[model samples]
Target: MTTIEKALIRLHEVDAQSRGDFLLQTLDARAKVIVTIAYIAVVLSFSLTSFSGILLFAVFPIVSASMSGISYGQVFLRSMIALPFIAFVGIFNPIFEREPMLVAGDLTISRGWVEFLSIMLRGVLTVQAALLLIASTGFQRVCRALGCLGVPQIFTTQLMLIYRYIYVLINEAIRMDRARRSRSYGRRHYDLSMWATFVGQLLVRSVGRAERIHRAMLARGFDGHVRILGHLRWSSTDTAYCILWIGLFIAGRFFDLSSVLKFL
Candidate 1:
């Protein structure tokens, strides 16, 4: 299968997983969303010199994956996609700032390298926290949770629409490409001219599809709000879930466990 086909399959698989009756999926969307936000906030609040303390935050995702019935391999693989961007932004740190921050016997480590690793840890933590949220809660309920959290309805509506639009757009692209491939005599790849034609056709088709979708929404009375079935309840477990994670996050932000370890 082609790259687009594989991507579509992965997308569908993730969607399927989100709807599963696992631990995290069973919780209130608002509670999960709030905990995710708080988790990310704490992850970002760590000092740049904090490597060991930040490492402790990995427990959050570990526990989440364990309870949520989502495989660690799957989450780890998905999380790696964002690493290239971090590498691009962070690759310069070691070169620009060469001053040594720490020394151990004959070995020395520069402050720049330390900062780069710190940034990478933060990126990974935040990304996993986000991926866990979407993978466990799905998109629609995430928006519902955001709405409950006092986010503007218009913003969440647009976010959901964009997600749905991109999904449809990918399907359109896959179909168009397949049609082109079927007509091609022996060509393995499209030429520049073919790409130009493909994009032009895609644009036109996308416009038409958008219009159709808009009309359908209007017919259904989509007035800047999306309502899904079932109500979100804040059970005692959800309250404890929030308190436990947030408490850990706050502890992470204030206390450096690495120092404690070294002291001991």
Candidate 2:
């Protein structure tokens, strides 16, 4: 199978996770989205030097994965996609801020290093929380929930469009790739020139395809708004779930539970 085919398969597998009959899958998307946002806010609010406090927040993802029946390994691997950019953002912290924050006997640790690690942790946690939210609640539901939460209609509609057509984009790419291979005559590798030509072809084809798709949608009475199928009702269970998670997040953010336990 081609690499693009593999990518499409991987995408389908990830999407399938959101459709399972798991605990999180059954919750209201609005509640899950709200709690995920609250959790991210709490995570970002932590001080750079509060490494221990951030460590404590790791429990949220762990417990969430356990309750939702999501695989930590898969989530962790997917979350690593953001690591390179996160590293780029903080790579210079150690060089710019060298004040010592910790002393272990003869060894000294710099504040910049701590802050860099803290930033990395924060980025990973936030990204993973979002991934979990998407895995538990499908992207369409999340977009609908965002619409209900008063987000601008255009933004939500664009998100839904991008997500819904990603498969079409991939399938188109696969077809183009197969055509390329068939005509490449014994050449299996693409040089820079070939890659450029391939990209140009794909772009032209995509634009034409998009125009046809828009026309078809208009012919079928397409409106500006995306129409989702199900109703999103906020039940008592959703309220309780939101309250429990957000309350925990607030307590963790302000209380410094790690220090309290030490005093006890």
Candidate 3:
């Protein structure tokens, strides 16, 4: 696919994630943020050589995605985006540690592979959990949640501004891409020089547009504080939601499901 097409497709996928009608989507932002943080902490607490229990924790994402109306494909595709960076970080595990960690009959598993798989599994869990959060709660609520969770207002405001304007910047890029396509009949792709010029012009245009928007906001009484989040009380439903999931998380943290199932 073309670069412009890929950008538009990703934007569409993001839009889909933001518009679902699901239980997770209806929860208080602060509750969701707190629970997500707790879930992630539990997922990461497992030892590197340990397995199975962490895999059992996959239920969180699957159930969450189901509740959030997010398809497996959507979560998988979005989650895969982080694989490269995680791979880069964990790539040296197998090379550096080759001692045997587990053995079954003639089958011996090296600590390196075990640690490597553990890292990848942890990455997948965290990524899916985060994507589920964004998909269910959307970006605006996420900002509100962070502010309510005592994250710096400055950080939340900047994040909100960036997310709000990113669409405008992308639309500007689309216009430029269309303009380029119209002018270049034989070759749709621009040369490196053309790209450089396009980027410089895009930067200039973006700055001017942003300045105008900022002034307009200021003229309309744009206060520095985020007024998006009202006073949120922890409702009974929110309490129940946390209890059910965090209970499961705590249970999974201490027990390996596979081992338990072997007894049954």
Candidate 4:
């Protein structure tokens, strides 16, 4: 099969796999949205100094990923892509504060190190939670949920449009790359010039495609907003899930389960 066909097939397979997951299908759009928001809030509220607390909190993503049937490897790949920015923000914490704040046996660790580690852990947990949410709920449900949560209409509409068009752009890029490889076979190694040319051509084509998409939208009477066809009604299952997680978060924070574990 052609590269374009292969890309399309892979995309469809992913969509199918996501659909086959029972836990993902159980939550309606609103429920998924609420769960995602609540999960993030709970993860963020933990104290940085509480190592055991963070470790206990970490169970949610692992369990969710398994239950949702999403590939942990795929989630890790996405997380790695975004880690640098997060690391950059947290790396400085360890540099500025060097005083020893805690003693574990004979080893002393700086307060800054604890803070930095916390920041890094927070970033990873937050990002992974988001990725899992999107992988399970799908992007359309997320956009709709955002809309329901009172995010500005314009922002949600743009998000929807960009997400919808991203596959088209990726397919176009793959097609262009294939064409280049076909013609360049048996030729000298590709240099910077060839690389720049390919990227520039892709950008130009993407812009043209965007223009055509805008015209298509206009023709369809799109009035600067996307209208989802269905309404999301929250069920009892969603409420239970939300309450359970929120309760665990509260318990974890106040009781310091991690410290208790170490004591035992």
Candidate 5:
């Protein structure tokens, strides 16, 4: 299948997962959002060299994904998209700090390397947590939850629009690609000028399409607020869920559970 088709399939898969009857799917979206935010904050609060301390944070995403029936392999594979950039951003750590942190049979590992690894681990964990959230609780619900949590309406609205607009953008690109291929007459590649023209045409088409979409929304009483169907009732289960996870997060952040276990 084509790239766009694959992307659309992935999008549908996430939607299906979100709608599935699972542990997290049953909880209020606000609870999930708040817990996710707390998870990220705790993950980021670890020191650069405290890799072992931060390793405990992985439990949150792993348990969450498992309870929610989300596939760990899919989340890990999808989260790899951010790995290269994360690696690039941390690649210089080894050069800046050469102090030996660990010694194993004459081989020495530097503090910089530890820091780099810690950064990489943190990024992977946080990305997985985010992917799990979107897969478990639909993005629309998450955005609505954010707005309800006092996040600016404009930001949440734009985030929702940008997410939805991606499908439209990709569909438009697919149409343009098909047209380009049909007119290429067996010629595989287009010149720079032709590619530039295609880009400009795509932009024009996208703008026109967006305008039509906006008009349709306005016609349907499009208020600036994001309105999801049904009320978000925070039940006792949601309260327990939030309390349990947030408490775990706080404990994980302040104490090295691994060390405590070792001592025990």
Candidate 6:
């Protein structure tokens, strides 16, 4: 198959997975959305000094990714790429204010260092929460959830458009990469100018394609809003899940269970 065709097939596979009827398929989309948000809120509320608490909370993403059939390695790789930006912005806490605040037998660490570590942990927890949310819930369901939550129609529509086009852009980039490789006889060459040219061409093509898609939407009676068919129902299972996690989060935050464990 051609590169574009292969890319299209892969896109279809992802869509199928998103819409698939399976074991957890019966779970209400709204419940998942609410629980996912609640999960993030709980994770982010952790005390910066609470290492064990953060570690315990990490199970959510790991389990969610595994259960969703999404590759953990892929999520990790994406996290690695996206996380450094946050780290760089937050790492300054450890750089200045070098006064010794805590003694660890032979070494003294400053309060600044502690704060910086807390910031780093916060970033990881927040990012992982978001990653799990997207991977498990899928973009379409997320958009629907957002709409139900009273996010403006324009914003939801824009989000939907972006989600739909992201795969298209990815496919375009992959096809371009494949074409480049074929033309170069399968030799890996990093030509900056050529890459820039290819990206420019892809951007132009994507814009043109978006125009065509817009026209197609108009032809099908899309008048600034697309009706989503699925209705969101919150069930007993969702309520239990939310309450359990929220209770755990509150207990962990207030009780400092990790510190108690250390004393044991």
Candidate 4 vs. truth: CA RMSD? 4.1
State how far residue 94 of model 5 sits from its true place (Å). 1.2
For candidate 6, list the clashing residue pairs, or say none. Answer: none
* Model 4: how far residue 181 lies from native, Å: 4.0
Alpha carbon deviation, residue 3, candidate 4 (Å): 15
Clashing pairs in 4: none
What is the total number of backbone clashes in candidate 6?
A: 0
lDDT of 6 by residue, 1-264 (tens): 555567577557556555644423446666667666777777677655555676666666676666667666766665665667767876776687577778989998886777676666666666766765665566787788888888999998899888788777887787688878788975675489887888889989988998999899899998888788758777897677668766766776677677777877
Query: Each model's TM-score?
Result: 0.88, 0.89, 0.89, 0.78, 0.89, 0.75
Candidate 3 residue runs with Cα over 4 Å from true position: 182-192, 229-233
Q: How high is the lDDT of residue 56 in model 3?
A: 84
Superposition error at 232 for model 6 (Å) = 2.3
Judge candidate 5 against the unseen true structure and give its global Cα lDDT, from 0 to 1. Answer: 0.88
Show where candidate 2 strays beyond 4 Å: 1-6, 181-193
Model 3, position 157: C-alpha lDDT score: 90
lDDT tens per residue, model 1, 34-62: 89888888888777877788888898998
TM-score of 6: 0.75
TM-score result, candidate 5: 0.89
Better of 1 and 3 by TM-score: 3
Candidate 4 per-residue lDDT, tens place, 1-264, comes to 555567677556546655764776567767766766777887788776655577687777887777788777777666766668877887887798888988989999898888877777777777887777776777677778888889898998888887677678778877776777689875544589988988898889888987997899899997876777878778888888778877877787678787677766
Off by over 4 Å in 6: 1-26, 46-53, 63-78, 184-200
For each candidate in the order shown, give its overall lDDT on alpha carbons: 0.86, 0.88, 0.83, 0.75, 0.88, 0.71
lDDT of 2: 0.88
